[model samples]
Target chain A: MIRAALTLFLALATVSPLWSQSDLKKLSDSEITAFDSKLKSRSQATETLIADFRQEKSMEMLKNKMVSKGVFKYKREDKIAFLYSQPMVYHMIINGQKLRILSNGKNQIIDLKNNPVMREVRTLIAASFLGNLSQVGTTYKISYFDNKGGVVVVVVPQSRQLSSVITRITIYFKGSNAEIERLKIEEGSGSVTEYIFTNQRINTDLTDEDFRIN
Target chain B: MRISGLISSILLVVSLAGCSPLLKEGIWLQNTPFAAGNVPYVYDTIPSTQIFDFTLVFKKSEVTGIVIIKTAGAGERRIVMTSVFGMTFLDFELKGENIKINYCIEQLNREKVILLLKKDFEILFKPDHSKITKYLYSSPDRLDALEQGNGITKTLMKFTNYNNKWPETIQIEHPYLRLSLLLKKTEYDPESI
Candidate 1:
């Protein structure tokens, strides 16, 4: 039961960036493709990325917003790790199909080959950071919106299965960096989890041992 | 002949069901007044909503997350457990004896697991003292144990009072399922709201 719940939560992973919703307009098809290409090229150029992240989770029913801080690391191809410092010490590393989670000084590694939900989560996390936005077009209906800050990429799940749990995922990029400055995931139950990234160092030297799991 | 055998077995089991309790060799207390302040998070006398850093260890796997428990009213409570990554694992609503599963992950959708969790939380919040057939007082622990049982299963719940009225820690143990839950009250931050 614990394993099931853990995997399901991991599948709905990632969070928000704060931006105004008032001064936004939907982009045309041509604009969407151009932005997608720009993001794709930017990701291809990035070899490694390291950032400090602050996650804020808000629910309409909850009295307080849940705040947590962590460090995020992503290497070329498909190596990603999130090490949380505040609240508690938790480390999660996703290297290819293997996912290693360390919580409370205990470690457990899970293979994502058998679980379709986890596979989709891997894809979503990768696309959110490393780009390849158009590759997941079949699973998510991509829409582009222009705002004063930069661009907001609205991704809605096409499948009824995923849509039932997660309503939408909005990725925010500021200025011309094309990096994900913020991400917000809206649940069907009126819960929103947002992540804000800062102090990003792109194309830095990150070794394979950084994402290793024993 | 088969029907007679089944009836005999049932009668024997029923007769010997309450003969032994899970908690053994302790003084049974009588006329111990049960108050609202005795149990943790039962009523809204002090702050209805509570957030805790929860950790569950089962077999070889261990999962840690944040659990937010809110008391809507007397018998109505909402429990939501979210991962450290901000994804929700379980969302449950309890109204009296009936429990509504607002949302549960597919992995934990088993009837046995769900029933166990429902019973666990119910025992934590409401704690039907009327159903408790015996109250065991252990001199070593300096705590009174509430033993509630029926023909099939038995459960024991113990509360440790940190303050003058309310308990700061609650421990629930189910011998049959080998399940134990430890709930501790965490410091509330007003600024986080």
Candidate 2:
């Protein structure tokens, strides 16, 4: 479950920056293609994405926000790692379709193919990295909204398996080349997990060993 | 002859069924009188919510996750546990005398697991013993949640690692089931409602 959630969350968080336009005004077909191309080109230009993330999780039950700090590394093509440093130490590696977690000094490896939900997440991550926003329609009933902060993309799961666990995912993006500033995941109950990214740096040097499993 | 044989086998099965541990171990009772002075118990912090770094110990293995407990819209309370990967293990709720389990993983859906969890969560969530039975307090600084049946299962859920007006941890254990939960690093927050 942790593998699936972290994978989906990170995939969505990373992909949120791939939408080009934040405006709501109706655009010509040419304008839409041009906008999509701009985001696609910018995303492809980068070899890696390295960012320091401050994740503040607000649950319906707790009054104080659950805050943690971590480093996020996404090497182009197919490898990503998220290492948590505060409150606790955890390392998660996603190489190809395999997910590995090192926690409690024990390492757990899971195959995305064997776990359907995780496979969906794997597909989502790949689509996001490939800048295929249109493919999301295959799994989710998506709607776009215009907000003061930016454009909000609300995705409701179309697949029965995914819907049983997660209700919806809402991402807030801003600017002409929309940068995903925040994302909120709503679960089966009324609980919500909101993630906000900060100090994002793109096209950095990240090595293969960083994504190795035990 | 066939009918008689079938009846005898059925009788033997029923007779042996009564010897099962769950039926023979005695039913769990929830009327423990335990209290803390001015400390924020689960129900005391009413309409409030908290998140804990949750760890569960099975007989053969252990799993770590986060548990979120919040009061539902009604007078009800809900507890949700998820794997670090975000997959949910269970979603349980207590509303009046009715305890509703919205969902739980198949492996944890055993009769023994549910029964013990029901009792442990009751002590953790509804901890107002002002009118219930009383506890044999061990210390001035420590508070405990007590369950009595066969000799008294006085595990740490019975004891609170407490701070001034705050509880740092609630450790619950079912010795027979080899199930234990260490709910640690509690952060007292404002009202979630």
Candidate 3:
């Protein structure tokens, strides 16, 4: 009897992790609607956000993942500053239709009016940081997954232009607060880039000069 | 007869000028081995794998991104370049004398461009020592230049400032295509994280 019990205990221990890993369940229609509204309300109430982010890019061919650490700041209306500090220094700031990039001591201000790629990037930034997936409802097919306490929102591009670049984008939001804890982008090239945000401060004081072109 | 002789002389001068090699034997040399530098052609040390912050400019358009070169196996390397905004421009696999484009964005999907890119990376990753016909060294800068050809166009590749056996920077230039690639190595300290 003791031997049977020991066998059962070993089996449960081995199988428990797999079960926990796959515990993320697909949310029903009503649950998704409620979650979407909560996200929208939280995003609307957020005036400013500042967070330190760690980015990991894993390619199929690479044995070692490329790791980078940076900080991102977002302001209401339209302003973002994404800065990388390690390995190399790269700063990308966006204000309305203007995109300013600083790298290798060179700075360039590119107008995003006719540039489809940059415009799409701007749209993505706004969707992930400023608004919820429901706000980008027209551009993507959105689905929700309940991962234990947190939620995972997966968005696939509805447009051919965007689909050619990315296969899907998965955003993980923490419980109750509708705060984005991570954003994972899967490319058509079989590589994945994941950004994990920490030390998030919402409604923080940020200035336009923070995202200035000059 | 005098005028014809003068024309013949002018034609001969022009032909000699045209036949002269684009890469001068010693004009690019700083030290000599009688004729010029007899330094043995040395290829850059094969690094484990490297990630570079690159800015690629062609014509008036400029793109800044990250480039990762991962050695897949023996004599094989995989190179991936992606934009800062998270769009992949290219994913290429280079095996011995073979190149495969796993993925490329539409903007850079042209035949001529792809051919040039393959040639560029080929020169970058594996400089053909067998095709090298001349070697020159600039002693002042401690740089080594190798002239490689395929019976038609010549390519000049230079490696300099090597730490141990690893080159700090590599420059590859193709005169005919007017294409150049400058690769600067970045130190990866896994323990720093």
How accurately is candidate 2 docked according to DockQ? Answer: 0.13
True contacts kept of each: 0.36, 0.07, 0.43
Q: Model 3 off-target regions past 4 Å?
A: A1-23, A113-118, B1-47, B72-74, B84-86, B129-134, B138-143, B147-154, B174-178, B190-193
- Model 1 off-target regions past 4 Å? A1-23, A113-118, B1-22, B25-45, B57-62, B110-112, B133-145, B150-152, B158-169, B186-191
Interface RMSD of 2: 4.3
The parts of candidate 2 lying over 4 Å away from their true place are: A1-32, A56-67, A86-89, A102-107, A113-119, A142-153, A172-175, B1-48, B59-62, B70-76, B82-91, B100-116, B125-160, B165-167, B175-178, B187-193
TM-score result, candidate 2: 0.65
Please provide, for model 2 over B68-179, each residue's C-alpha lDDT reduced to its tens digit, 9 standing for 90 to 100.
7776644477887876545567878877656788877554678766766776776665444223323334443234454433323433354455556456676777665577
Candidate 1 chain A: worst-modelled 10 consecutive residues by lDDT: A14-23
TM-score of each model, in listed order: 0.78, 0.65, 0.79
Ranking by DockQ: 3, 1, 2
| DockQ winner, 1 or 2 | 1
lDDT of 3 by residue, B1-193 (tens): 9999999999987875576564565342233352343344333335456665566665455667867677656568878888765668999888887888999988788987777666666655544323344555556334366666643356676777777655667666665555556666654452331
DockQ for candidate 3, C-alpha atoms: 0.39
DockQ values, each candidate: 0.28, 0.13, 0.39
**Clashing pairs for predicted structure model 1, backbone only:** A15-A183, A15-A184, A15-A195, A16-A183, A16-A184, A16-A194, A16-A195
lDDT of 1 by residue, A1-214 (tens): 9999988776645221223364478888897777777788888888899999998999765767878789999997888888988776889888999988887677888787754555666688788666777678688988778867488988898887677667788889874868888988887656889989999998888999999977
